[model samples]
Target chain A: MDRLRQHIEQITPLTNEEFEYVKTFFSLKKVRKNQYLVHEGDEVKYEYLVLSGIYKVFYVDEQGKESIVQFAQENWWMSDYYAFFKQKNAGMFIECMEAGEVLCSTLEAREKLSADLHKMEHFFRVKLTNGYVALQQRVKLLLSSTPQQRYEAFSHLYPDLIQRIPKKFIAEYLGVSRETLSRLYSASK
Target chain B: MDRLRQHIEQITPLTNEEFEYVKTFFSLKKVRKNQYLVHEGDEVKYEYLVLSGIYKVFYVDEQGKESIVQFAQENWWMSDYYAFFKQKNAGMFIECMEAGEVLCSTLEAREKLSADLHKMEHFFRVKLTNGYVALQQRVKLLLSSTPQQRYEAFSHLYPDLIQRIPKKFIAEYLGVSRETLSRLYSASK
Candidate 1:
């Protein structure tokens, strides 16, 4: 689990024993492309750490429109965080955009880890703070940027995802139509 | 300091010694009505806990149109968190809508608290996690709710703030115009 070790190091370096203790809670799972991990209205039972693959966190409006909120590639964490920690029904659906593997930990295991290891608790604490900061920036982006600017920002933020996901998904993530995205791309070119 | 004790109690019980240690960093500050506490693009050096009064967090567009993202009332925390934590220019402006008092803490104090007090560190971690959940739900509401539905939801979520803030500010918070908010209010009645 080089990826797991590296991910934990990004927060706070852990000893081999400490990593092993934390690793006891995580189990690797494979998801096929287009498969659902968690659906809207279901309780999100696990927080996933991407090992290899892409995932999209999105929601369907009452009128059946899909709005993509986030894309989690390798090294990113993905979950209906609102549901996972709160035990509430998810407002978003998480699905595999490309077949991939993820290290999964349930809420029970996470809580137990918090009680058993203060270091794990601190790791998650730093993660949540960083997560909070990221969402605040996203909200600001939605408020301050134009659709064209958003596209450019998206391209810069996830350069690899640009070639991997369909144009429609990118358009939806930027809150624009496919046609608008095409026009913006051509204009920039 | 009474407010800090109360706020901490709402989240988790802290011992008197722990609370006292945490309280040393905060100083009382008064913000005048219509004055900015933190501005977009300014480095956010402090985070405030509202002791009394109301504040608005908003961003202005290129056209100078303001959209209120949130309003902080009594006992709520206020900051351009992105800037406060990241040491970057803030993306939102925080202004006092009504003259108020707050307890302020700087980034240095925040880091020191996390290192010095495990209980305080745990308390903030839980609080930030809750904040992240609330923000995700707000984004979901924006995606799925109509203006009327959003106003109704907002009414249910912050009836106290709605009663205290000006209608124009509420409209901005909901991403609607004054006329639209008026219609929604009349329709509800």
Candidate 2:
């Protein structure tokens, strides 16, 4: 909860009393490695705020090919937001990559917090703004970057993620062949 | 400014007085066809709300290949957001595809509105949420979808855009070759 307060305070400061109230909306849960948090077709009830370890938000096609939507770690939020906000069944899957703890909160709770506190609304808005920028960068990289440029950008942006995640998923995320990933990796060495 | 009020009110209703105050922060401009709202290396000072226009926000690579980030029409917000929000030089370009009008507002005005009014904050947050979901869908499509699937999804999502944008730009936006795009178009027929 202290970490959660720290995360929120990074954008907007909350009074101690206010944070106590905000923390109540979030319930903590342990995530085991390989555990499925949100499964396709399941109701997406809550968005997770990662406290530690890594998680992959992804989609599996009819032919069973996987596309990684994002890799989230500490202080990051993860959910099938298309489902979470609309109260629909999940169209994607979220899987725990390493054991960690996450604080879960419902969309209703998110809205309530915003309505109840202007600071909370500002906090959420700021977070969304950063997320929007990151997604824009992702689209640009995916569309125009060569494998080497992509690898370098990824390495620069998420050096920790590069060290932590498997090369297979990294290859998929970069939209490069596994062989190409190997060439980039060995060349970077 | 009625358009601005209506667009914001789609997510969070605003009083006439409040909207009047909000309108002061925006300046309306008539855009000519092929006009660039933003260009690479220029300072991105404002985000635009398309009052009446078809616009493409895109990036051109070193080899002069263009990739469309988004095709925004009436009621859509467009900008080099990475630069706009951060007060940095633009990394992309936004060009008008059809002559129309846009309301431009700076980051300061945006922050001022969000800070001054909770309803305005909610409005911006909701808009960002929708944009985030759309980007996520795009990332998924780009990562694995076939040309036919991409074309069909684009057609379904933006039938209006399909009718307005050229097939060449459409092919580039979908990350498909002109030949493949032609095949998809004829096959659909």
Candidate 3:
């Protein structure tokens, strides 16, 4: 797909022939709102690259408490990465929040692409580098930031996400109560 | 340097010549306990591969609260990675907890190595993959795990670290009060 080309090319350029070869590894799937792409206990066979709409990757704990690991939007990647990498059954679920399409690729295909193309390897490395940095920032925020600080940082980083995602999920992501989030929302307004 | 070669070879095999070429990009540094490898507001120039001893990567907040981001032991890499990749001033500090040796390599050297050798690129990518997975797991724990769950997870994952790191620092890292961590410690025993 053109979007996939654009996404990969954002890191490294690919010739038409190379692009064609790379595209063969991915298959497109259309998803509907409230549909599940991945479910806990199922095998996580593919990681999705968002072509449109939004999705949440999360897990429910033993106490039946839900915690969102991340959200994926257009041009983003999503999977239960730990299970995906280990070839284990999923420990998380990816649920569609809006109707969308995604390009799915297997870990085998990803490894083959990287092995077969130096440019693809470079592209994946750079993307992973960026992802690693972002997760590090998130870890720090979760560790030390207060509710107010977390709300401010989230809004500053993802103004669009704030407008798009429900307030309750936003509150959960910030580790803040709904009342606290409501107060912060009112103050920011 | 042999350690460096061995570390890389754990992921991808390299010819002696390739290993020699790769080692040249790194310089060895001996660190003393309490020495800071990076300080907030300083330009973060290198990411260090730990050879021996322990180090803490952390940041101080406005109210002078210290938060431990990660602990590095032998064969681990430590850096203000966001700053290192972005070529910006460090927003965190890496302090040596025990006298040790580290192999320091600059961002330019890393890029050059990755560009020059496909094996090196694969090596870096694999390391980043592992690190990314570990951080994601940490984020999940921080988001939902109780202090007891956190302690059990930590001890299960890094029993050696439990013995090596100070109990106070471990409490901070787990985002638990000292008394709570102490109770967990006693209960575990």
Candidate 4:
């Protein structure tokens, strides 16, 4: 897809022939709202690249409370990465939040692509570097940030997602109560 | 340098010539206990790979409360990664908990090594993949797990760390109060 080419080219340029080869590894899938792309207990066979729309990667604990690990929008990648990398059964679920499409590729394909092309290896390394930093920031915020600080950081980092995502999910992601989130929301406005 | 070669070789083997070239990019530093590798507001320049001893990567908030982000031991790589990668001033500090030796490499060196050697690129990518998964797991634990669950998970993941790191720092890392960590510690034994 053109979007795929654009995403890859954002990190490293691919020749037309290389792009053609790379595209073969990805298959497109259309998902509907509320559809589950990955479910807990199933083998996590693929990691997806969002073509359009939004999705949430989350897990439900023993107490039956759900905690969202991350949200993936267009051009973002999503999977239960721990399980995905280890080739184990999923410990989380990736649910479609809006009707959209994604390109799916297996770990084998990912390894093959990187091994076959130096540029592709560089592209993946850069992407992972960014992802690693974002997760580290998220951990720090979760550990020490106040509700107000968390809300502010989330808003600053994802101004676009604030309006697109439901306030309830935003509250959960911030680990803030709905009332507190509402107060912060109004104050910010 | 042998440790460095061994660490990289765990993921991808390198010829002696390749290993020799790679080792030049890193400089060895001996750290004293209480010495700070990184300080809040200082520009982060290098990421260190631990050869021996322990280090805490942490931050002090406005309230003067310290939170441990991670602990680095032998064979572990540690940095204010978000700052290190972005070439920005650190918001956290990495302090040596015990006298140790570290191999310090710059961002420029990392990129150059990866560009020069495909095996090095693959090695870095694999390391980041594991680090990313570990951080994601931490995020999930922080968001939903109870103190007991967090302690158990940490123990399972790093059994050696439990005895090595002080209970006080472990409490901060797990986002648990000292009393709660004491209870978990006693219960675990």
Candidate 5:
């Protein structure tokens, strides 16, 4: 697949045998729209790469209000990252927003990959570094920007993302209420 | 020197020759209280390890109000990380709160070390992974907690830190203003 080829290229060049070895760990699964992929308190067993459709990662507070943290579409990766990488209980839930397919790999497989290939370890190190960079930028945006500005910035970055997801989910990600988002949206319009 | 030795031990075992090689890149510098170590827009050419005392990394808005982003004290490493690692203009200015001493290394020296020794590269990667983990926790805290809860969490995590930096700086890092911080501080007290 083009996606698999792209993913492999991001890491070190894999020999045909090594590629086959790594491929053994990945299992493909189909997800239905509106289905839950992971829930809070459950252990996250794998990191997934999306092949098609969209998924939302969210956290629910004690009051049962959900706050969307991120959305992953085609070719993007989604997981309860803290749980998957650090071996902890899920702090967030991931749900399918559209019928999708994903390639999944578990922690045990990742460990073997790391052990078998130093270059693979380097690939993962770079992956985590890039994640850290994104997280830092997100924190800065939360600190420096207003809700309207954040929404605008999000629109600019992912022009079709808002069109695909619900308004309430967008509000939650921006750390605002649905009503507030409605007002901002109406005002901007 | 003792602090430097301790810092090195926390990462990896270094041979005498390796230690000598590392020492060549680091120079001890004393920062006076109320003075800056790096400024916003300046190049972040060096990384500093706090040997003693306290420092704050903060960003000033267009309005000239400072928002603290990080604090470094004894045994902590401080830098405009976004700038230093990405080789961009500094995102924050680092300043000494109390007269402090730091063991400093330049970006060029670190690159040379990485190229010269595989062990050093592994050591740096491990250190970077630990830093990445801590930053991930910080991002989750920022996303999931209220300002009051965040402040409380910070105090719980770093009991000694409260004694070193002012309340306003802590509030800034938590994404709140001085007046609000003053109120929260008094209420908690």
Candidate 6:
């Protein structure tokens, strides 16, 4: 809860009373490695803010191939956001890669908090601005970057996550083959 | 400026006084066909909200291959978002494909507007939320969708754009070969 307060305050500070009120809308949940916080077809009721550990938000197509959409770590938020906002069944899965805790809040909670606190709205807007930029870069990499370029860019962008995430998942996230990723890794070393 | 006021009001209604203050931060520009609003290496200053016509946002890699990132039409916003938010040089280009009018605002103006008006902050937050979700869907399409699927999805997601955008640019946007896009086009027929 203190971490949550710190995270919020990092953007916009709140008084003890305001913080307490904000916390009322959030519930802390312990997530085990391999836990699926969101499953395909299930209602995306809560968006989670990771407190620790790693998680992957992904899509699995009809051919049963997994496409990593985004990854979440401590202080990051994850949900089948399209489904969450639209109140539809999840089209993506959010699976924990390592044991950790996350603070969960409903979309209603988010809107209520924003409506109640202008600072919260500003905080959310700022967070989304950064998220939007990251996604734009992702699209650019997907569109124009070569395998080596993509690998290097990914490494540079998520150096910490590179060390923590499995090489296989990193390979998938880059849309590069295992062999190519291995080649890039060895070449870089 | 009525359009700007209407756009802001669509999310959060603004008072006459507030709207008057808000409009001061924006300048409207009429763009002609083939005009470049942004070019790689230029200082990225403003994000634009379209009032008419179509614009293509794209990137050019080392080999000078163009990759279409997005097409903006009436009511759509376009910018080198990464650079715009970071106050850096543009890494992508925004070129007008059809003559149109756009409202432009600098990052400072954006921040000032948000700080001055809580309603404006909420409005921006909601827009960013939708933009974030749209980007997530774009990433998903890039990572997992086959060419045929991508074309169909693009057609479904932006039916109006399909009718207006050139097939070649659509091919680039979908990361499909021109021939493949043509095949998909005919196959659908």
Q: Please tell me how candidate 1 rates in CAPRI terms.
A: medium
lDDT of each: 0.84, 0.92, 0.94, 0.94, 0.78, 0.93
Model 1, runs deviating above 4 Å: none
User: A26-64 in candidate 1: lDDT tens per residue?
Assistant: 999999999999998888889999998899999998789
Top candidate (lDDT): 4
Tens-place lDDT digits, model 6, residues B1-189? 999988888888888999989999999899999999999999998999999999999999999999999999988899999999998999999999999899999999989989988888898999999999999999998997889999999999899999999999999899888999999999998
**Top TM-score model:** 3
The C-alpha TM-scores of every prediction are 0.95, 0.98, 0.99, 0.98, 0.86, 0.98
Best by DockQ: 4
| Residue pairs clashing, model 1 | none
> What is the C-alpha lDDT profile of model 2 across B87-186, one tens digit per residue?
9999999999899999999999999999999999988999998899888889988988888899999999989888888999998899888899999888
DockQ per candidate, 2 decimals: 0.57, 0.79, 0.88, 0.89, 0.39, 0.89
Which regions of candidate 3 are displaced past 4 Å?
none
Q: Give the Å error, residue A1, model 5.
A: 6.2
Lowest summed lDDT window (length 10), candidate 4 chain A:
A168-177
Standalone chain B TM-score for every prediction = 0.94, 0.98, 0.98, 0.98, 0.91, 0.98
Look at candidate 1 and tell me the lDDT of residue B40: 84
Checking candidate 4 for backbone clashes, the offending pairs are none
Q: Give the share of true interchain contacts found in each model.
A: 0.38, 0.62, 0.78, 0.83, 0.17, 0.85
Ten-residue stretch with the least lDDT total in model 6 chain A: A169-178
Q: What is the DockQ of candidate 1?
A: 0.57
- Residues A1-189 of candidate 4 have per-residue lDDT tens digits of 999999999999999999999999999999999999999999999999999989999899998988889989999999999999999999999999988999999999999999999999999999999999999999999998899999999989999999899988888777778899999989988
In Å, residue A136's CA in model 6 sits off its true spot by 0.5
In angstroms, give how far residue A28 of model 4 lies from its true place.
0.8
Residue lDDT tens for model 5, A102-168 = 9988988766776566666656655665666666666666776777778887878787887898898
Per-residue lDDT for A178 in model 2?
90
